[model samples]
Target: MNEHYDPGQRRLPSQDFLSEPARSIPIRYRPDVLVVGGGPAGIAAATAAARSGASVLICERNGYLGGALTMVTLGSICGLYAVSPEHITPVVRGIGAEIAERLHTYGGTSGPMRWLETASLPYDPNSFKLVADDLTAESGVELAFHCSAVAVTREDARVTGVIFEGVDGRWACMASSIIDCTGDGTVAALAGAGFEHDVPNGQAPTTMFRFGGVDVERARQISRPELHACLERAVASGLSLPRTAGGAFSNQPHSMHLNITRILRDGVPPNTLDTRELSAAEVEGRRQLRAYLQAFREFVPGYEGCFIADIGASIGVRESRRVMGDYRLTLDDVLHEGRFEDAIACSAWPVEEHGAGRGTRWVFLAPGTYYQIPLRTMLPEGIEGLLVAGRCASASHDAHASMRVAGVCFAMGEAAGVVAAQAASSGTSVRNVDFASVRADLLRRGAFLGEDRLTQPV
Candidate 1:
């Protein structure tokens, strides 16, 4: 009945099983604010909180920073500028603008380009990662990689600390405030926060791929309609094409980034948190990429001799868990350009909803206008010491469609970080902080919260 049984043993009695008594995990570090998920929102939150005189710690599961921007190889950073045919207005400022400025300084970004009606700033993913690392380090934020938040430690209504699993082992880190920026709202969900799921079908998840040896100049010569027409012809010729009107952009000489493949997770919901299904989706995405390579080589003119230079480190998941916060942003708010008294961020990106298969629909607001994202959307209802940012913020599906872009995420994160720092330093709950003071600090930092004075001239 020894517990040290043979490894090749077929069976062992339950009483003979080895077990360890529950013990307290070693505390690795204690910070005023602990930001989980090192994507755009987490980076912004950690940097801003640290700059606000709070000791901050940011944990990321990825080896590098820049969340979706770098991991998914998302081609562009959208939602920074207001959408209008007459002129473009940059509304997302503060840390978002700073990141873009850094990218521009490195010649890593392309000027504003209109896509699906809204304007987006495309940048080199490598440049974004470099800038994110520099800013996070410079802000005096402690960084840990290959670490994932697994569970929440709470006292009554407030989250006291977070338990994470990493290569070293399970450990706990205490913090006065926690920011959930895992895109999928991992931290908030673990803290018993209510959330929504897409159920039958979520917004289509795409696996971005890039092509090398492409004739970028020649590809630019063809109109989008003409290119889609070519794709239609390819589909008619028995090419297994998932989407026909998907587009690609030239990022470098002879290099093009394409966001075309659509992986339908039919049986498995996008937000199920099932590792097996996620792995299957990734495999299917790669398979689809190969099929696209064949079609590109045969049908497209510029891609005749091109080859896939890279594929995304992970698939681009559009919708996941939308945490139920104090305020749920609705479509009417976006379409009518609704303003809020406690507005923390502004977005002008239209509601770009992608369905399961081929088509995507767009709905725009009035010209030279945008809607405000209230601070309540980031404050999960009934959850203290927790703030939700990025795609997981409280919003209706349609409203999320517009505000889930990178630039908007940056704004939200900055606001959440400042709020967290204020609450942590004051030893008060996030709900008890004075929002007017937060606004004043944001304005000083160049964040455009739909304020006329802060809005940059086009």
Candidate 2:
């Protein structure tokens, strides 16, 4: 009767296995806190831990940071603000606000732009990468780029170290505490942690792309509904479009960043963990872009002269493996404004689900209200000495849709970093760390955790 039970159970394929001789991998850096993945969550976790006076090391598969913001080439930073008819107020602060301010200072963002019922900050991916580098460097967080976590070292229920394969070959890094910021829960899965991976009912992945030579004024005038209508027209004319309604933002002149083009295989979302399917998805994603370019040029008003400026290095996976943590956030929690005693972060982002259909499913929260994400959500259910943050944190599929955005990930990572640092320094299990102390630390850092009531417009 327990949902979290047998979280890792799945259908297995009958395939021959190979045995390799055991070889010892060379030990690398042993920091106080080892944060895996250099995306928004990893960046925040490493920086926060380092700032908390812990020696932190972050390993990234790509040479650059920014995760989805840079690698997937997302157009805008979502989940940072709470929306109402009269006001758009920030709900996620601390590291998230700092990153936004820094991005603006670098001329990387178009401030906050309101669209539909929400507001998001449009940013340039290159500037985002620079901002990430500056944040980690200033916090004294060491970085190891081009490293992919392949295995995890566990002492009973505790994850002690991680094995990674990089350009230099396989190496091991030990730590007092580990944070799994890899969006797909890579480290947790390898450590035999329970996780939920529902490919059949999972949100479909997208291939983000950008267009140049656009009439900015004309493009800006086209609202979401109008764009959908235009795409519908294209569809009626025998052009295939998996998703007609999606996000489009412009931070530069004569250019548009598009979050369009849903990628599916055989009418279903591809399982990204499978190498053969993942490779096929990448090729399929690019192939969809060509069709979209033609659709925009022929049907859309301002995109008649538009050409493909760039495509994301990878497909944007909205959902994958979600680790089973101490508590799984639910849809009721998001809609009913769930608060927690050990709350670490707040999110006002709506439940935005992309499925195997032309339109997405969006369920918005009440105006000017938000839900608190507790620190327990990041603590793996039966695992010690490890924290899983970002999209892969414990949550139901619906709750994950809302908290999976960049702003919430930043908040989660920041909290996890602080907790990890305390655990490592005090030689305590992450679950045993004092919640009140962690809450105070987060409050001192300017994080909004739904404790201070905001003035809502009547």
Candidate 3:
């Protein structure tokens, strides 16, 4: 009577079907300063706020903590530091620096390079997820994985907490303050904040992938003209390129994150649902990826024997909803390398554009040039007790291109955390917090808070 053998037996019902009293697990709502996201920015913000002595809670919708890092296999952390003015400006400090440092110790990243405007170091995505979780947990920040923040609860103009949707079903959690690190500006928009990005149609999109057994050097040898020629021939011969957007061709070991496939879609307003018709985009992306690889084999020298490795679990969405704050950082500021009095973080990452659906445009900062990101950018306009980090921070389309890099976002997260902690300690909104004290504390904590090449204390 093999218990497993069941010709007459039926599989258990997918749902609870037992005719008996059912037990319930109490729904837990525990986050003093709830941060909605667990990516690099969210992790940095949550960890710093926890260190600042608040019971932090991080709601990461994904099963994993590292958002883009794990999902996209974003192997490198770009823009943490830069070689500007002949001296490296290590703007991404504090928890972000600690993470980068620890990863550097593990040989996950390399030192500053001249070719790339900012210093980018490789990282292990799996290990990064573990480290982020460990840091948050160690700091006593309760994290909810597989839990998405679907809606927000607001009081007047301030955000009070969030509504979560997950396996446990819908639940609510109240918080003293909230940080929108969702990259897409989830909390901000839900709280009725204005956001904008490139209009008409957002730049082409890209689906990143990495493969093994690649001839790194040989692949690098393929010229743009050669690629264009092959692509032209392929089109003429009935092969088609993907219609998705283009992004980065990030570095990898014996492989690379091919971000060449670009798709163009309209940039919808914030709070409203973003449905730009991407259901068929991924399928077309895969088809183009396979086709392009085949083309490279036939035409390029390095791709003779290369094959696919692994596609990203989710698409690497670079640009999205940006919070409308008191001060909207714009292109003119970037052009003049403006530094501000209330600057929270500084960045030298260039204005990186991916596709030309609207036509790719790049405006590079001169050597030794950098710009400041003010605290005003984090606080949504006409909103109190809320902050934004990551790609959702206040910036014009072109400015977002420069400041939305991972390194810069990490710095922004750190800034948000410190400000949130200070405000919490003094029982005030971030806008009313003592700027002098905040700046002093950030400087004391080794965060880069400088004005005119001078670091000042309160």
Candidate 3 lDDT, tens digit per residue, 94-203? 77678877766556555444444444656667667777777888888887889887667778988887888888787887777789899888788778787774434344
Model 3 local distance difference test score: 0.70
Instruction: Single out the weakest 10-residue window by summed lDDT for candidate 3.
Output: 1-10
Q: Write candidate 1's Cα lDDT for 244-338 as tens digits.
A: 77767776899989988877765333433556667888888899898889888889888899998989899888888889999999999999978
Candidate 1 wrongly placed segments (more than 4 Å): 1-21, 266-272, 452-455
- 1-458 in candidate 2: lDDT tens per residue? 12232222444443544456899889989999999998889999999999999999999999999999999999789989888877888888899999999998999997688887888899999999999999999999999999899988989999999999999999999999999999999898888888898987898999899999999899999989999999999999999889899888999999999988998989999988777778899998898888899999999999999999998998899999989999999999999899999888889999999999999899999987889998889999899999999999999999999999998999999999999999999999888898888888988998888846675321
The clash tally of candidate 3 reads 13
| Model 2 poorest 10 in a row by lDDT | 1-10
Q: Which pairs clash in model 2? A: none
Task: Judging by lDDT, tell me the better candidate of 1 and 2.
Answer: 2
Pick by TM-score: 2 or 3, better one: 2
Error of 1 at 196 (Å): 0.4
Best by TM-score: 2
Tell me the spans in candidate 2 whose CA falls farther than 4 Å from its real position. Answer: 1-15, 455-458
Indicate which candidate wins on lDDT. 2
